[model samples]
Target: MPTTPAQPPVFTQKKLPLLRTEELMLNMGPQHPSTHGVLKVVLELEGERIMKATPVMGFLHRGVEKLAEDGTYHQFIPHTDRLDYVCAMYNNFAYVRAVEKLLDLKVPERSEYLRTIVAEVQRIIGHLFWLGTQALDIGAMTVFFYTFREREFLLDWFDQLCGARLTTSWYRIGGVERDVSQDLIGQLRYFMKEFPPKIDEYNVLLEKNRIWIARTKGIAIISAEDALSFGLSGPTLRGSGVEYDLRKAEPYGAYDQVEWSVPIGVNGDTYDRYWIRIEELKESSKIITQCLDKLPEGPIMADVPQIVAPTKDRVFTNLESMIMQFKFFSVGFPMPKGEIYCGTEAHKGELGFYIVSNGEGKPYRLKIRAPSFIHMGAFDHMSRGYMIADVVTIFGTYDIVMGECDR
Candidate 1:
């Protein structure tokens, strides 16, 4: 709990008793360090207590949903990368899986296993970022260095798997761009084997620290009902004890093949949300290692060559293959003129794409159910009655990225 700052006595007439102090309107950031991205929270405060918090958005919006209408389905892969820029793998998986569902395509078992591997890898990677920065927000600075250091290792593995580090359009409409090299698999296997001790180190650093507990134990508590009613998911929902992980509740990819536990919180406080992410890091490692062990030997790309990319020899030699190479990029394939909703459990929450197709090369309507956007909706409700300074902790725990929120 933050101590309220003492206010000077205000005399209206002849040294009379103090009247009500004027409420202060404080804007936290478009540049504040504690913000996840370019987000500004307009807070109405009386002394140190926040009466209202309005999150102003649209700063990073590049009209991604609108832009999707102008391009072919294959052309929109790069757009999903910018939504949750940190965990682009899952975004790629989510969008591609939605298209796959529409196409009624069965991805190869090998591709499913590999997708699950990278998805879990991104889960660990994303939460590691959240753990480090969220702890740093509450004054645990060392965690930032430790977490980002491991993040670099993961990024190197991603770089090897795909060329790009951050905004990787690695996953294709049917499958990935290429097969996972054995070298990359070996690197990931090594990481899965050795990552547990690192998580233990993060726990030892701040799990029981007095200052961390005082700052986060009960700060920004949201009840289960409110969390659900406000459309929260991911750790934010699980923190409130809702067992609603899309992977577990609705299995996709190779999630049904793997065995894991979803960590839940009893208190639904900042600390529980923090601890859940740490536990998820361990669970993610387990899933990745399991996928590595069960990885199948088969084609990485699907059999649908009209939508899937063909071999270079085929593209160079065959006239039909040449036209497919052109049409796949210039104009995409058509669907059955129906609406479908598919989502995957991305790093933030239930990242869904609702696509209404008019049997055209492009979608008639496309909307992204970005968890960052949904979580920000409850900002004012949660921040009410908390000390103004605790707003930093609340914001950190939700892990809002303005790119995703504003998109």
Candidate 2:
């Protein structure tokens, strides 16, 4: 729909050929800060309004799926950590779930509960990251600093659980690698109680601020039907008044046992998406609180010694244990030859992993469905008729991260 004067008109005038219209084509990114990553939006503008916005991607392509084919089953967990680097835990859970389903393995009850707790905590942290960065994108710098301060505590907790902070490949195919201590649970409980006050602080900063409301109110509206048609899930779908959440619909990892509500927005506008995440943070915090209280006592890993590592004492003392460990390390468990898709509600939207295994340790094919990619596809539809300044607000409100978009 974009027309530029530099190019010949679609329909030429016979007598008044001298007449012309002025429209400009602009490149916004591939290297701009507001994009949230290396995303390039080619905008054809008619003065201050965007006529068409075509998003160009692939700047951050790491060939993750290709890399998966070459790595061992255990080795590939770290690679998933790199995809949605902000919320690697969810990525880890999604991928492992797909692989586990293919293997038809059931994790221990305690491990499932722990996985739920860690994942929900990470979900809260991921939303906090989005809240802060999106606020900063729209020119509220104080919220960024405030949110990061809280994130630091969560990262510290992650470090305490696993040695690694960012890429905690703590999730194994059948279960978690190890158990969390009571002290860590206590720290998490303290965090859950304190986090709501921090969320309140964020709300005070911008929730009712006149400028924030004006910037967001009716910008970048996605209709419920269109959102559903586009396969929009997670907060994006919820923002459009759909109450479908993967945790509730396809209850994996003890999510069925916990009680939580899927928050929806009536308008599906930029403001609604923002509010959906804000409300989700509250809900995720509550889930974490319930999980912490219900933390059970049992073996963290399922007793599938062929798939999981043996006890440290057994491995150190017995020759049979050494051989089993060697077999587990060298020849990975033969997974069922089938394909399965597992999706979870990531910070953005539906993050899904489609995995095909061929009775080998490595997967035959792995494909990731990144929510940012689909959401970004609707940019032109969302941004048309909005002012150039409102374009920034719309992009920030959608919270599209190029890491997943380009993946």
Candidate 3:
């Protein structure tokens, strides 16, 4: 036994240039399943903790604002449907209201109620989407199937409302395109009764499951002040205990006329946001039920003959009605030369539109203050001190849609 042959003394450098700890950069998505749409998030990480996060957008840009400038006010409704396709009715409702604000046009009471019904339906659809995807991101696949199934019924309701499902273009400048029928009302009544229980089932799966709580309980906490400073609205803002819902704060459509309350949260974490959206699902159901019960008995379209399209019978039988319909569709009604910004409580947040009119059929310049876009800006701010895994939770809880964000 050579008694551990002590070869030469090896100089084990005691302080080796302070182990250069280079930051690790990671991109979450531009084509990810969890991200619903094309969203590339650049994350700077040290081990599993995040330092800085930048959300890279424009992957779904269609020059929507510029497209608004080129198209007529009515023509842009379909474009808006493409913005937040998961909540196309809300998109249609928001843009139409924005254009109507420029014209100072009055929507009929019946039309307002109808708009509210569809808008709330869109809310349910949007939140169901958020819930399913968020749960899926956290490794709960059953929630997605359950939510999307209920959502499909809502889509069919939208189809009955506008003949198309996703981009229904149901809402028009002064009013909605079609009125809800007795059959549709019956369907909603059935859904309103049946859906609350399903939400409970979802809660059973996610509300306090060990894995869910472990992953989301303390992740991505946003303070009330920081939430407002970040321009967050809808569930994200309310989840921070702000009670700053546009539906309650600045009532639009039949929101002021109706009797429903906006839900608020206490923790402002992922779980709080999740709970807020779940409550919103109930609130939205209540709104739809009220709208259906209090459904007015009058015309759905506004009195603005220049803007609203004539009925098909009127268009086919009468010469003046035909010409007016043609003129309205071909050139569109001219609005006052002014600027107006109108906002609505969309599924994600306060989806708003600012229109600059040149006394023309089309807008001079149009700008969208999309909540998804604004919410994503706070990513870098909110995800600073959280772990890299928490960044995904933040994105899910924030509920961003790249179509709306990029546009």
State the lDDT of candidate 1 residue by residue for 247-331, as single tens digits.
9998988999988999988777887888788888988888888889999899888888777976789999999998988887788
C-alpha RMSD for every candidate = 4.9, 5.8, 9.4
Query: Worst lDDT window (10 residues) for model 3?
Result: 1-10
Q: Ranking under lDDT, best-scoring first?
A: 1, 3, 2
How would you encode candidate 3's per-residue C-alpha lDDT over 1-407 as one tens digit per residue?
00121122222324458687678999888877767789988989876677789888889999998888887888888898889877888998888888888888899899999888888988899999899989888888899999999999989887887898898888888787777788988998999999999999999998768998888776777788888998998888887788787788778888887788877787777777888889889888888888888888998888878888888999999999999998988898888898988888898999999888889888899999999999998888878767777777888987988888888
Which candidate comes out best when scored by lDDT? Answer: 1
Residue 287 of model 3, lDDT score:
88
Query: Which of 1 and 2 is the better model by TM-score?
Result: 1
Which run of 10 residues does model 1 get worst, by summed lDDT? 1-10
Superposition error at 51 for model 3 (Å): 0.8
How does each model score on lDDT? 0.86, 0.82, 0.84
- Report the Cα lDDT for residue 376, model 1: 92
**TM-score for each prediction?**
0.95, 0.92, 0.93
TM-score of 2: 0.92
lDDT tens readout by residue for model 2, 245-301: 888888899888888888878787777888888898899888888877787888788
Error of 2 at 71 (Å): 1.8
Model 3 scores a C-alpha lDDT of 0.84
Report residue 240 deviation for candidate 1 (angstroms): 0.5
